[model samples]
Target: MISTRKKLLAASIAALLSQAGMNSLQAQEVIDEMVVTTVRMSEPLLVETDPRKPRQPLPAHDGADFLKTIPGFSVIRKGGADGDPVFRGMAGSRLSLQVDGESVLGGCGHRMDPPTAYIFPEAFESIQVIKGPQSVQHGPGNAAGVVKFERNRTRVTEPTVAIHTSALGASFGRHDEVLDASYKTPEFTVRAIGTNAAQNNYKDGDGTEVHSNYQRWSTQLSAAWTPTDTQFYEITAGRSDGEAAYADRGMDGSLFEREHYGFKGSIDNVSTLVSNIEFQYYYQYIDHVMDNYSLRTRPAGVTERAMNPDRETRGGKFAVTLQPFAGLTWVMGMDAQGNKHSDRSSMNMAMTDYRNLLRKRDAEFSQTGAFTEVSWDYNTTQTLSAGVRADRWSAKDHRSMVMLTHMMTLPNPTTGMKRDDTLTSAFVRLESQLGDMPGTVYVGVGHNERFPDYWELISKESAATTSAFNSTDPEKLTQLDAGYIYNRGNLRGSFSVFYNEIKDYILIDSAFRKPAAMMGMTRVATIARNVDARSWGAEADFTYGFADNWRAELTLASVRGENKTDNRTLAQLPPLEARLGVHYDNQTWSFGTLLRAIGSQDRVDIGRGNIAGQDFSATNSANVLSINAGWKPAARWMVTAGVDNALDKTYAEHISRAGTDVAGYTQIARVNEPGRTLWMKAQFTF
Candidate 1:
């Protein structure tokens, strides 16, 4: 249900903008413009989203939502908030994620709070995506590449005070506000930022209500000192809290609180051997609460259930850039992390107080890694690069999962012990300019090793004769990343393809169905097992400037994964998809529209997938259209508005699970996308 208060707020925002009358203003807009239409290919297969210039229609609510605009990226939406990002066919920890160069992890075992869930995209500077396992600089086990939300601090030229603020309102009682302010001088600086966003449940194309609703807020403070041109030290502290409702799951997130603290220092031209050196240390904490009563009504037969989970992570990194020769560059770094996951719950299944309950640590994980990358410039036409990294990981299970099958207490099957692994990754690539062709072609291959995360380790029902946690081994990923960038005249295009061969690929087989008679409650539990898998995929993003005031942007993505052990296709693999856009821009205004089409996925292994979600037959191919316009009559303020899914078509993503179950309905669990909605926003920079 749409909240009345939010509706009033939306009305106020609309009136405020309408009263401005920007359409007739003749003032020239001189503010820095952010582009929602397209992003230039910064590097081969690396895409950067301009946070200020967001695209129209369905604006991103979180980090994962924002990533969907890029090719080869998708989100498994369980609700309006905290969606998990999927790249190609990889999800979860397979994709390395960093915010402000800090690594953070979620505490929910069911993935109600993913890493991206903690990020408010509008408050960040930029988002970058590196497709495929082409490099090891970010982190280890990045078989699906890396995504980074960066906030860069610029050196103060003089004493300055800057502020940026924006507000948004939309249908379904959606409201968002953001503010960032910084004061700087040559010697020191301080910055403060905050964001608030909320939305109510939405209806599908059929006008059926969905359970997705959320309200979230975040704030951060930073202080830095710069005594010299080549040296600087900064400290950042932040805290965030939120609540969300999910239609796909039985429970909702009532409390999503997180805290972060980080310290960073950098020095340039330290010595001839060391060109640059930087160090970072960060501490992150996640305290999450999931229940059935806060955001949704409890069903008659269902007991009011609630869970409180916590995760603490501390990590640090030290890197050095070296220039031993004029044409050679080397970057070497080491990173380490220590993590602890625990939870407290009330067995009474009421609105129980978490503070009154005793906390139990379920698992502990730790990692240490070292990496070195080198690039050699033989000439202006050719260059060679290579990198290698190694990591040591360990995990310990402390949960007491004593078997109580059929009302009998049996010995714990999980063995509740520790496991350790040593993994290594490396890559090499060659690049050369295509002479006279106005394009660059590059090819590279890499090997990545990823240790099993918490889901695979402590979330399983142990066996009597064997331990599922111990049987699982580190996943070995060997892949090739290659593409070319072509820029000639007004047309610019880039295409990339990747192939991967995985050994000891961990596949989750959730085909096991335990009857209530045997387990006292019916449950569909996932079982982790090893499999041999091979995958290949390709995606391309292109832009062409044509006509007097027009430009076109196109994107295409596809992937195929197969399990050799079971001789079946990989589960949760999305089908081919395409997005095309056209835009018209004038000196003070701009407008655009986009067409999105999703292909039906026929190659799927039912009842198998990672922690993201399993594929269901309810998925259907669909086509959607949306359009938006913008007005920027003054440099201090600008306004943008758009409608997404104007056709109000009903469709479900292939990676989504079945919605709330309904008797006698086959697709009862298929969570449908939101229906036709309207929204508008105004941004300010001064």
Candidate 2:
């Protein structure tokens, strides 16, 4: 039956492509499709191919799952899912993720959500990835990088509605479903989206059933009122819930819930010399529960092993845009947020006996800032752009917990402290046309300042070394960014280089006495001090269209990290990576193949060894291959099929489930990448 289906689909695609007159072509590579544009910049830019959106349907899993297609981008391979994004050797808090305009801090001290899991990628219209410290408007501590997911209001001239649905059946009982729709009219517009997905525990290509089963769902409804041409109003509300199994951590995320509400209005087409003015307010609440035996039952007598944490945030921003001259624009905004976090644990899943271990921990952070960008167009040959921003931010942290009528001594000068931070950043870019090649030559430079978050400042521990919490400070980072872009009618590419230095680099030293003192943990009595360090890397992306129906994309990247104190390789720096892909697309059919290669890395920091490092010297690399084909059976409908990891490669990623201690052998324990797998999908638009 499967063979028949494949043949039918292939024939349909070929027919469509042939009818579209796309038959004659040379061999070319296929790349992911992603368009990147920021609110601060006038033009749009594309991240590397890997950093771009995958060409295939997103797994409908989580935010991170949608990002794996880009080159130089890899995740710590745990078991089934929740693989965190690791970019050029940086992971964890080093990389920051924002949804809409808010941050969803993960509950696992080890970071389960990694921000990616908390977002529904299909719900957003665009995603922007900014490498290095080029922009500080999204909050501080982006020494590694920043990812922003955004959804823009949809506008259409006529009344219409659209719906899309797809499903997948694979080995290990994996299945998924998605439903999204939008309605538009002259006076009002409405949109709604929902999804349901589950997997009954998957087995490695070796046929080992990983206890990685999971189920998740989300729903959103939004409405906008544009009664007139000069003004508009919108209201949006959404809810998300899910749970995933965890093999690497002691606790599995048994319950995850998110609630979001927002309201905004804008004044436009005005005669007050104001280009645009907008007012907005947003509120979100997250409730997370993690337990050791929730998904996979634990042994008897295991009394207290779960963390129930709930976080709430309320914030609002008011922004204004002005265009005083023909080629200049300025955007200024002020925003403030208040948040509270509380945590409590118990022995059983049911609430039989409760303890007053935690009442409610409170924290507040606020920011006020102004930004402006000026651009000048010198005829059609040259253009220049410059921008700068300054901000004042303040935050407070406090914890008052009394357990069993016993008062635990808050570590260190537990007395809270406060500081006022002022940050300034700027950037410059110039572009000019190149002869008759239809290409543009460009150069850009930027700098930014960031402040430490409440968690990074106080959470501390040294599992390998004995370090007391006497001295620890916020991190300060500075980066130098440079890049050039070139484009022709059929070929395009860009290269970027970055150098970032930090003072008080957070180093994890487990060898010290009372190790477990190098981390961001509050309940545990440990210390994570700050040292100096440096990180630098280079990345390049290119795409070439050799023929009308064929094209290819190539990407290459590398990163190096050093601990200034001891001058050693930073643990878990991503290994060198390269990606090559080719795709052929015609009017009726499309086909593509992608090849990814990873280099061997042996850098080690025993004390800071994450899951994948315990056995391997942080060095394991392999080649992965994937192929796909799509056909248009008729107008408004399409069918697609593909195979992932065609070779069933058995390689362990530095942060994958392949790295573990299973049958007692000193196994590298890297979770096996999905073996040879096949999938088919069909879509119809109305």
Candidate 3:
């Protein structure tokens, strides 16, 4: 007899194929747009841009790099690539990141591979950023915001083939190759994508080489079947692998392997009351390995050590849209996700002992959620929108014992213990057009209750307990968001602000110490604790077209946080930053320059931060200049070249992790940014 999981999987695939036709018809109406040099607000609290388009400061190498180009975003650099993304002073699970309607998680205990690590920017069609907790449509626990990377399905009335390819070469032995090809017909469509990127160790402004080198590759295949104009179905599969050397940790990532599968479908005109229905299911698996001897030389007198961790995730979503009344629309949906994590390790490298050992299950998690959102056009110039969501979250501790050290072990206090919580989140917003002006304004308020994540529960210990699994409390947040967008003639700009008050906020303290033993020996331990916190910030951007084919743009962002429980500044917050750009563009050629300035940050709460890293010290101000140019030699071919960090300014971001000593690498106070670098890219479409 077929199992229930197998039956569900088969049904999902069949349904996806039946709905492929509707998505293909919609794709036929899209028009290819030009390259985007700068992204701007598309709607209140929303920003959208094409990920395939080339941008300044060199093309992105990963998802985190691309996000850093947006305002109110930062990266916690671990190496030359695979950095973790931070938005609005929040990291980890606070921000919801989805790719093609699927949530992919990392398998590293130290966050060497964030969700963005497996993402290749150029492989996606569009990237959408919904700032603040202004909507509850995606998933649960998105207290900060939501980011979605989507791919559009294409359908053709006649047999057609499309191909897009690009090559990039830059300083420090860096090179990349990307290819996207597709074949489409009235009956079916198939697409394939592949990417390869690698780089040698890069030097800081002082010409000192850092232990940051990496190589990565990925491939994906997708197919869609369209039976009719109102039905569409699709399936996708992909895999990726990579290795990265980090300067902030004792070990380097030797392997990052990922496998993913997805099925989706949509049906239009389902009924008179229900206008549309959509459903999707996805499965993802990650196998990660890290060691001290793979990328860097093992330190003398130190035993070679390696660790392998893996995670499996499965999830699905279903939704329906209804036109209940004139000028009013409603969308209702439900989603469910489950994940499991396991680990294996070895103290010796020569024997490859870890490969022969069985993986020990450490944690399991699951969540089921339902949501409804509504939009109403109150008048021609005014609109109202609201959404509410509830999620049932469950977690289980699978560890039988905890290891205080290689020689010390203790019985797990929460072994086989399961915890469950029902969390609620909601948001409401109102938007209105300025009278007699080409401008729009909006205001919103949101409340979110977020359950503790794996890192907070199983990875760290409590202040006095063996594990934080049962000690840390869920976080409750209330935030106010407001923004304005203005567009008139050749001038356009946007400004947004947010304020947040949090109760029982989860905080990580990396300096916690165990009591001294008989020999008066103290050991440091990282712990998780709950605290009250508040934060506020603002982001603004403006652009003006001056002389013909000339434009000037300015963008600014800053955020501040306070730990009310401790009466100190919140740790790991990014400092004030601004960017100014001048550009001249004609149909055939373009030239641009960017000036980036970051202000000094003095507020600090050292040894405390998020799961990824902690604040070491205050950071100093820095400024850098860069220039780029692009030329279209033919209708289907384009070339772009640029110089980043033109002034060779040696600097590191305030949120970066502190550097650790490593063999064959110079140790620094913090992982520094790349020095002066040159890069070039060529793209072709056929």
Which is the leading candidate under TM-score? 3
Ten contiguous residues with the weakest lDDT in model 2: 35-44
Give the poorly placed runs of model 3, Cα more than 4 Å off: 1-37, 405-408, 516-521
User: Whole-model Cα lDDT per candidate?
Assistant: 0.80, 0.61, 0.87
Write down the lDDT that model 3 would get. Answer: 0.87
Estimate the TM-score of every prediction. Answer: 0.91, 0.83, 0.94
What lDDT score goes with residue 404 in model 3?
65
lDDT of 3 at 448: 89
TM-score of 1: 0.91
lDDT of 2: 0.61
Once superposed on the true structure, which residue ranges of model 2 sit more than 4 Å away at CA?
A: 1-60, 136-141, 347-359, 362-368, 375-381, 400-420, 431-438, 462-471, 509-511, 515-526, 609-616, 657-668
Report the lDDT tens digits of candidate 1 across residue range 1-686.
Answer: 46998878867844543343233322122112233744445567688876756565465477888887778878887877788899998998898998888888999877898899999888888888877777777877789989989887778889999898989898889999999999999889999999999999878888877788899999999999999888989999999999998888768899889999999999999999899999999999999999877887776666667779899999999999999988789999998988999988654455667668888898899999999999888799887888999999999877675333223333446557888988999999888787645567889998999999887666554222223667777889999989887654445677889999999888877775645445577655466777999999988877655554566778888999999988999888888998888877674687788888899888988888887777656356889888878888897888888888889988777786678742222234577778898878899898
Output the better candidate (1/2) by lDDT: 1
By TM-score, rank the candidates, best first: 3, 1, 2
